[model samples]
Target: MFTHFEPALMKFLRDLQNNNNRDWFNDHKQQYEDNVRTPALAFIEQMDQWIRLISPHYEASPKKVGGSLMRVYRDVRFSKDKSPYKTNVGIQFRHEVGKDVHAPGFYVHIAPDEIFLAVGTWHPDRDSLAAIRDHIVIKPGPYLDAVEHQPFTEFYEMAGNKLTRPPKGYDKEHQLIEEIKRKDFIAICPLNENDLYQPDFCKMVASRFGRAQPLQKFICEALGLRF
Candidate 1:
């Protein structure tokens, strides 16, 4: 059974609300480990069970992906929006190894920020990033809709600093031909921290999550708070 969050743990996160900079990030490593990382570890462990129950066909991804804290920088002189910090945490679901950027599914921004789960459209591919390109261009509707409804305040005090847009040049091929994609990503705040726990919305989203791919009941069952 899952335990309720400790008071001390929440207080620690509250303290990080106004904190910033690499020094602050590094200085709080121990607290991060004790309160945040440890809890996140427990979360993933439980999530593994959910994955197996939801998509049995899925071969479990590595247990160690994002197993450690991440650096808050992207060394991209070749591109734009070069920030000094990574605004999100990410975990990949790839069938193959070796930086599987083309493979589908990655969780994002689960620590020190919005704990949103992304189901598609991120590429770490260097040579040929066609699949990722397609995700951003072809099926951008569903993910974009989810992004609009994101509520960062629930997770991060400094969520205002996070990425507001899908990275530059997200649509190179230009195939996002839908009203949903055309709609300005709204970025609505969550009605409640427990919004994810709403049975109606949760069931609706989980049911048609990937269109044609109705999610297993186990997935819907595991996504919300188990009462």
Candidate 2:
């Protein structure tokens, strides 16, 4: 299924690592599409099915969630620091765009070396903040046991925006000014270079997605392997 993804995913990671810039990323936009964008969507499509089983209080006819790269340019007019880009995947769980209270979902960071996913009570149509607040407040375990058995493990919080972790206290160690806005997280198990997409690992991940039934089904169907 990810036949079109392997090549581009490989190249984009290589390019992004050395000289990261808007122009650099834009130049290889198509590569990003072939690898990251396309495959991410394909993956998220499977993810949505899982979300359905887990979050029943969702919009019945919701829009397909999407994954996108956060812009590198930070609007300095409001603040001073200008990070060219964020190195994590940010997804919105909604039917469409144009709203701040998008869907609830998670991200996977290629750097600081982490992989995982999570969701809160975010439903664009009904309760956006409520969903997020609930998830963050309860402190749901980011890494499920099944997912932990995979090749990668979800690690400590990535960019402060993913979700709220233990309070930073007065140290102000985190980068983001507004942290509470983020409300969920996920981390994968460890993996070796030669051990990607292993059937056992994939099956374990599929099993952990118990709440996300639709998504689990999609994965099962994709590999012709069932949980």
Candidate 3:
């Protein structure tokens, strides 16, 4: 059953941030499961049901590993930092059709001083990016209307990396040129620490996501899929 996240969850994450080495995590593995993974799984299970009501396209994987619960271990192979573990908890509700992160998805991030909900396509493949851009050029009104909707605008702001100049084949003077330049199309809503501590946090998150459904559906439709 879903209740409230224990204060120790935050404490454990904070401690992990300071002592990111594997040795420290190895010693605290059980605590990690009890405080972090367990509750996170419960949250995902509950969110799974809630999100289905919004749209059957999204999924919340409940597996203890290789599922919606992102691995605490960081892939430091390519990066210079080489930290052994991630400081935050990441939960993604990906579209059923998406093979990986390249496709449209909804994300939840939890960490010390950083908690938010996001939805959109992040780092889409070349073809997918081109398709999204073309959709923006052809039917900008729906995209604009979705983001500008009062329910969505009340919480999220349009966020993503963008090209400094307009992309080729698109006019700089186009009304939606700003959106066409975006590489990652996303909307984020900040969540306070107290928000996570609430017993009704799951419901609150679901309601917020429902409010953002128009935006989610907009992206899905742009990609020629259903939400």
Candidate 4:
């Protein structure tokens, strides 16, 4: 039974932002477990049931490591900012066949600055990108139905990078050219902290996810995968 994220989660993350070093994190490790990791794992565990209602193909694994919950450690190998810890909680419900974040998924981002729920693919590979574009061109009606529908547009706004010009082999004059020009197909819904603190948070998330289904289904079809 999932309820709400403890308020302390945000406070811990804000504190981490100011002190993003290994020593500080090690000292505050118990706080991280209580306010962040444990609740996150519980959320993921409970969310699996709701997610299955959306699509059995998606998973919300509750494993402490290598599961839906993203790591708190920062990958600073190539980054200029060498801060060793992340300041946000990231949870992703990805498709069974999906390999990475690029796969069509539902993403939850929790941070002190902002909270948002995102759906669709981010930075898809060359072949997947081409396939989605081709599918959109071949079946514009369903694509439009997915994105332009009241349920989808009322909650989510289209996001992600777009090509400056028409993508190669796609006609600039085409009706769905703008959508086809996208390098990433993602939609985001901004959220308030209060929303996460609500006791019915899981229900709210599932409802919004239902609104995103048309787009998710289309993406799955484009990729020749089950939704």
RMSD to true structure for each model, in Å: 10.1, 10.4, 1.0, 0.7
Candidates 2 and 4 compared by TM-score, better number: 4
Tens-digit lDDT string for candidate 1 (32-96) = 66765565455445445445443544333435444322333555687785444444434433222
Give, for candidate 2, the lowest lDDT window spanning 10 residues.
58-67
Q: Which pairs clash inside model 1?
A: 72-85, 72-86
- The candidate that wins on lDDT is 4
Better model by lDDT, 1 or 4? Answer: 4
* Residue-level lDDT tens digits of model 2 in 187-217: 2223332222443433333344343433322
- TM-scores for all predictions: 0.45, 0.46, 0.97, 0.98
lDDT value, candidate 1, whole model:
0.38
Q: In model 3, which regions exceed 4 Å deviation? A: none
Q: Candidate 1: where is the Cα deviation over 4 Å?
A: 1-17, 57-89, 94-102, 106-108, 111-115, 124-192, 195-227
What is the C-alpha lDDT profile of model 4 across 1-227, one tens digit per residue?
A: 77889899999999999998999999999999999999999999989999999999999999998889999988899999999998999999999998778889999999999899999999999999999999999999999999999999999999999999998898999999999999999999999999989998988998898899999999999999998
The lDDT for every candidate, in the order shown, is: 0.38, 0.39, 0.88, 0.94
What is the full ranking by TM-score, best candidate first? 4, 3, 2, 1
What clash pairs does model 4 have?
none
Shift of residue 118 alpha carbon in model 4, Å = 0.4
Candidate 3 structure lDDT: 0.88
**For candidate 4, which ten residues in a row score worst on lDDT?**
1-10
Over 46-106, each residue of candidate 3 has an lDDT whose tens digit, in order, gives 8988889989989998898777888888998899999999999899988989777666888
